[model samples]
Target: MRSIAIRLQELDDDELEDFVDIWLHNRSALYYRTERLGKTSDKGRDVVGFVTDQLHEGDWDLYQCKRKTRGSKLGVGEALKELGKVFYHHLKGEYATLPRKYVFVSPRGITGPLQTLLLNKEKLRTALVDQWDETCRTGITRNEEVPLSNVIRTVIDAYDFTRITYLTGTLLAKETDAGPALSKVLNLVPDEAPEAEAPETVCEVEMVYLDQLREIYGETSGLAFTTINDVLAHPVHAGHLQLQRTRFFEAAAFDRFHRDNTAPGAMETFKKDIFHTVIEVYRESHPSRLDRVNAVMKHIGMTQVSLLGRMSRPPVRQGMCHHLATDGRLRWTR
Candidate 1:
């Protein structure tokens, strides 16, 4: 397996920030809104996660991204300057409140000096004050030299140093492993299909698909298959009915599992892909409605859809046609 660290090494500064943006979406309960404050003198925020609806005016957490080269790490000089920008902008009223958390994000992480300061809040605060002139003064703004006055000193002294922290490349790579963006950023392995068991009897929700199936059965056999019991009485049709219903339930389970694990609308996006893939086949001439159903089911096996790494299953592919049928997006008879 290729290490995620190697994958992280490939991204540039902007790409790293973009990944951070995608990563933040996983924390929905903690942050109501998340935004990437990209290049353009962004007041020190590379990425922001706003916990409240009040946005920057209220509580927010800021991430300052640094994509360091291989074997190199972020130094205290660059880190302090970023901190200065956050406070300087706050002092200048760019935002009403200070960030609840000030995080330094880098591919290689921070150097020992910065890491030491971060662990000790008092030392971190003292280091910021001491390094203010050398690191932060001229670096914060291109124009004027920011003098560390009493007001600025007061803000620094009062501000919480514990909020300052960092995330190493290795830690970040581990995080991306769990979310939907993992495949987007790095190569993801496919999952195996599970056994899909059908229910003993027909359920209300399966009616739409079963209804379509009944019509196809009646059209082919020339028998009045009016009810679920009527279809169950036929040995041949009953066996086919069980298999089709299993496919439907397998797809339902697939959808439910992905909804819980993958990104928003992941299953829906896959469903749409499957619909477009087989819609042309559904429109084509077939011998009978039952043949049409079988043709669509067969088409899915050969056709490609954007399969989620976790939801890659044979039954899932077959079930999507039934799902589309239930949704009225595809008619097996027509």
Candidate 2:
């Protein structure tokens, strides 16, 4: 919450408008457009969103942002003044229609008297009329003294006071849940618990050897070794295969950690290192099976087969390797 308050304090008018846009967008499905009126002639609104699902075809929700211009807190005078602009504009038809919701967003918040007035919907019109001369009448117009005319009074009286809403910096921060997407923009960590580690997506390492073992057994027994399933389904390897599944998940967790934290160019470097490790392990475990490694790499899309020497196969293709790493099937460090 402190982080959100600090972030709000740092935003200028443009940034605050954007913050409102993002916050509103994250919290609902209503599409939002910002600064519909140019910076100089916006009346009182900064961000506007449609209330219904049909995009621009619905009732409008106007969001007016009032940051602390020179004061420590936004007082009643300031709150009433901005609200007056909205009311004035709606009377003048600057807004095609009165907004269904008129929201005020500020870091300093509304003054205590105004806060109380806000709680009682029925009294808002009377309060605004009573305070209009000092708080809003002369303040709203620039050229001539636009006093609280009978027309303005009628508009204010007929206006729905229930449409008014206030959002302080702390309240907005508590309600907004865009998580890292928002946090990244603000350069702050999200106010949520860390996520649990996820397992990787690749196939198990031992499963890679199962086919070769089936071939060997078939050749020895003088039977057609068409599938590793036939050999591995035997009760003998069933326990060992189950153990290999555990290893696969362990490999997945390690890959997930690396992918989560790996910097941009570092992933390429890591892949190269893992490929070399795969080569070294394959050499140690299946020295005569370099052909198998070559086949595996080719199957995964390592197209530069000519690069493979008479002795060694190239590692898996970079894209495929990353995919495997992401899946948790490919682990280099056993």
Question: Clash totals for all models, in order?
Answer: 0, 9
RMSD of each: 3.8, 10.4
Pairs of residues clashing in candidate 2:
200-252, 200-327, 200-328, 201-327, 201-328, 202-327, 202-328, 202-329, 252-328
The model with the greatest lDDT is: 1
**What digit string (tens of lDDT, one per residue) describes model 1 on residues 153-254?**
999999988888888778776773345545445544334435567889788988988988888898889899989879988978988888899999898887
Q: Candidate 2 on 152-175: residue-level lDDT in tens? A: 888888888999878876776666
Q: Which lDDT values do the candidates have, in the order given?
A: 0.81, 0.57
Error of 1 at 211 (Å): 4.6
What TM-score goes with each of the models? 0.80, 0.58
